[model samples]
Target: MTHQTLPTGSVSPEQAAREQSLVDEVVASFAGAESPRLRELMEALARHVHAFVRETRLTEEEWAAAIEFLTAVGHITDDKRQEFILLSDALGLSMQTITVNNEAVGAATEATVFGPFFVEGAPRIELGGDLAFGAKGQPCWVEGTVTDTEGRPLPGARIEVWEADEDGFYDVQYGDGRTAARAHLFTDDNGAYRFWAVTPTPYPIPHDGPVGQMLQAVGRSPMRASHLHFMVSAEGQRTLVTHIFVAGDDYLTHDSVFGVRDSLVRDFALQPAGTPTPDGRDLGDTEWTRTRFDIVLAPAQTASTS
Candidate 1:
């Protein structure tokens, strides 16, 4: 298509009409998509994107800069480090997408953004076992139960837990094959589960990439709230991906990824150096923290279709 170049400043009626027609042209191009849902999505996406460009009166230089930023995000992504996911998180797109997919169903646990660091095949631990696996941080005793929305216990539910250590670094961030600070365990017949993990601390989302630079440019802090990641799944139940945030984390209100939910926050009670542990494991003179996160899952029919 071709068009006459309009002068800068207010858009005349002719220019606005041309812009709308351009959007219509793009939307029409997707009319023949094989999948009805695909056609709808592409057409809607085209209209919204074109509207944004027209509304912002985006300059050529700005478009070029956006392209460059996305290219950098792609260039830095790999099997382990997902810069694009980071970018989405920083922009709140990840959380928005999660919200759109996971609707609240009764008393079910709310879902949150799935960060880029999750790895498959995390080492399995038995109930009441330790997940630290030598990662450095204050020991935390985490216990919880898995139940359906109706409060019925769901036995043998798989719970995957992962978190950053004292230094705010996930095992994957270390770039070594060694895994720590992450593990999976199954609930007992009563739906009760317990394990030891590092006490979570507030940390920044990984900076030093395009996402980080974008955050800095927008005057936004990359800090995330202190929390432990949990992915719970049971047969015939909708899998829940969420975080249990420490009650008093300073970054709770300003989590860079917008992953916090008031319902998910819980107190991490601190025990004295000589306090007795629930599992009878001796911590010697070291203080420990403990928190519980009883999870309620929706039925499989409530799972996200997207």
Candidate 2:
């Protein structure tokens, strides 16, 4: 007796083309959606996704795995944390998006990504105040002037500052009841601001999620360069979100997220105990590190007039 062979399940060329046509049809229907902004975003996303599928000829198993990964990312998020933001950071998308949105306006201060750690309503302190709150780390003094594009001081500029301890961990990471390493300070009449805090050290990003898994798979470390975060703004100038990186950090050349700019790296000098403070207050018996940084802002017309 002879047996008959059955047809294979794989699609023919014609069938594949028909499948693509269906995708295009569905994407085209989005033009009739009510929200203009949503429609625009969906259209762009659809175009890129369709192109990616076509280029890579992605498999069903790979697509399902991608969905599962994204679902896990969402499941891990809560009120005080965002796993997706961490994912964006590890992928360098966060910094890239910030760069795209914040173009330098005529030599204005550079803007960097605002990481997820900044909590609203940090306690405001006067210029020359101590942000360290007596925390443990090498003492560090940060003094800088906020200025407009023409080199004029911008008085009363609000500056928000935050950094990890010398051990490279933020208060939030250490749980509650800790307020030793963050503060908000306003510029003085001369556009000058000063604060005392612990020197920041290189720290690792959260490495217990999908993003972390990806990093391990690629043999990459998650440590960022030692740096201090700053958000500075004035009434008539553009807001600047940036970091002052410690010079000679091992990770400077290999910052996992590519956030380092040459102009932003600075040297921290060792000052003997009892060194005179900028405000004439003596830091007795406390050897400290000091660094001066000056931020230049662009006028309103040069800032966001674009």
Candidate 3:
């Protein structure tokens, strides 16, 4: 550990050349970490990030700016606002992490980022019921079935759905005591479920924060395409967290959170008035949109390994 001491506040050629070795020394120091996995991750992260810094010749000013940016992100975070998740989505790291954890084992639903807007305690609904109560949006009919990867029906599955109203506001966003757009329902014995909901509409990620400022600085849009969040689960099956996007949304290709997938997109078929209602909720001449998004889940055994 003994080494030649450079003069105070002075840099010599040999000392400058040894800067890279300091990174290696820090990486080796992580070997004594209590958790083997943690140690491994720290070592790998140190190596990769140190290489990035050296390769890019990152300046002190750039490092200071990064620290400031992350500090600002932290300052804006709260129970209702998840600035860290925003950061992950902005950099595409959230979707990339989801893609790594979820493999295409079969026709099962694809996983995506669990966006920050989801809230618990949504009211429960029957198989054929309306999810949007007092919500301001055009009526839409949504129905689907739950099945295993082999296509066997899974009855009694819990299907949780939530989305923004036509005004592009989630129930949690409104200060009023109203539960507009969110509910949970169970699949019937036939593995079929249906519910009336509002049409998904394009909305911006919660901006007005550091993340939003960064997006604007980079000339990027903050809009997420129209989509409904679904989290389905059944006994003996893996929980599936996903979203079904509107077929022709403008921001489909450029979702700010990068949660869109081709398989998850479905045509929101427009139904003209007088079409026989499935559950008979009695809507007068109002046209409605309909979509069927059957969900398939992998077995728990496979899910755990994945």
Candidate 4:
């Protein structure tokens, strides 16, 4: 194709420069137009997006496809799920953002992505109660304590936990009530907690969407290492959303979302069956897994201090 350059005299150099000035003026017009933080975010986003377009020499075709991909992502969202969040996970953006915002708070626990599968109002159960809801898998005895940075027990910390079954699928993902994998529990006076559940298995992220296409294009797998999600909170302490990843899982070093942290990796010890629970229920004759983890939280920082 033959290209036609702009006529030499069609526009003056000053006019071209003025066009660039208009771009800045348009963006600046939005500054101070809303909440201060929002204004700053908008301005920075605009600057970076514009810079990216220029730096990449983005073409109309590429831009149109990008828009279409985003539109499809929006279409895939619903009350119980968010496709954009999945996209963020697949691209490692969600984990990166969380890590950036969670700079260590004096030995406080690390925070990780609250993935797309979280549902509010999980059933509340006492420490050591079963979260398995009678599902079949490698029984796991999970025990832990909630404490402050100074090692003081947090008597009433609430710990919300969830994980996949032996087949690597959440309860909600496998139809209603097929499993009971989500539970909420509170720390006792000694800050001790425990629960019985199935040992989590490594699973693949949903790879039936645009995110999957992108992963395939890059020759990346969509699998996440075995892990259990925990959201723990207590009065006067900062809430922490994190995961206890199984150490030595094949996918740990190559977590699709980059959510693995050395501090979060834990050993799941295999225990012979007949392990007795304090409640006197024989943990059956099947082999099980056991793990113990502790959570330490930082004092809540006010918005100004944060």
Worst 10 residues of 2 by lDDT: 1-10
lDDT tens digits, residue span 1-306, model 4: 111122233567675465446457656877667587777666666666765664465679999999998998888777866788889888888988887766687778888888766778888887779888866578788998999989999998999998888888888887665647888999999999998888888998888888878889899999998999999999998889999999789999998888999999999998777776545667677788889999998888721232
- What is the C-alpha lDDT profile of model 1 across 1-306, one tens digit per residue? 223233346878888778777877888898789999999788778877876787779889999999999999999998767898888888889999999888889999999988877889999999998988889999999998999999999999999999999999998778777799999999999999999999999998889999899889889999999999999999999989999999989999999999999999999999999999997899999999999999999999987787
Clashes of each: 0, 0, 0, 0
In model 4, the clashing pairs are none
RMSD of each: 3.2, 7.0, 4.7, 5.8
Candidate 4 least-lDDT 10 residues: 1-10
Worst 10 residues of 3 by lDDT: 1-10
Please provide TM-scores, in order, for all candidate models, with all chains considered together: 0.94, 0.88, 0.91, 0.87
Give the number of the best model, judged by lDDT: 1
CA lDDT of every candidate = 0.90, 0.81, 0.86, 0.81
Instruction: Candidate 1: list runs displaced more than 4 Å.
Output: 1-9
Scored against the true structure, residue 218 in model 4 reaches a CA lDDT of 90
For model 3, which pairs clash? none
On the 0 to 100 scale, the lDDT of residue 232 in model 3 is: 93
Tens-digit lDDT track of model 3 for 60-88: 99999989999999998887688998999
Better of 1 and 2 by lDDT: 1
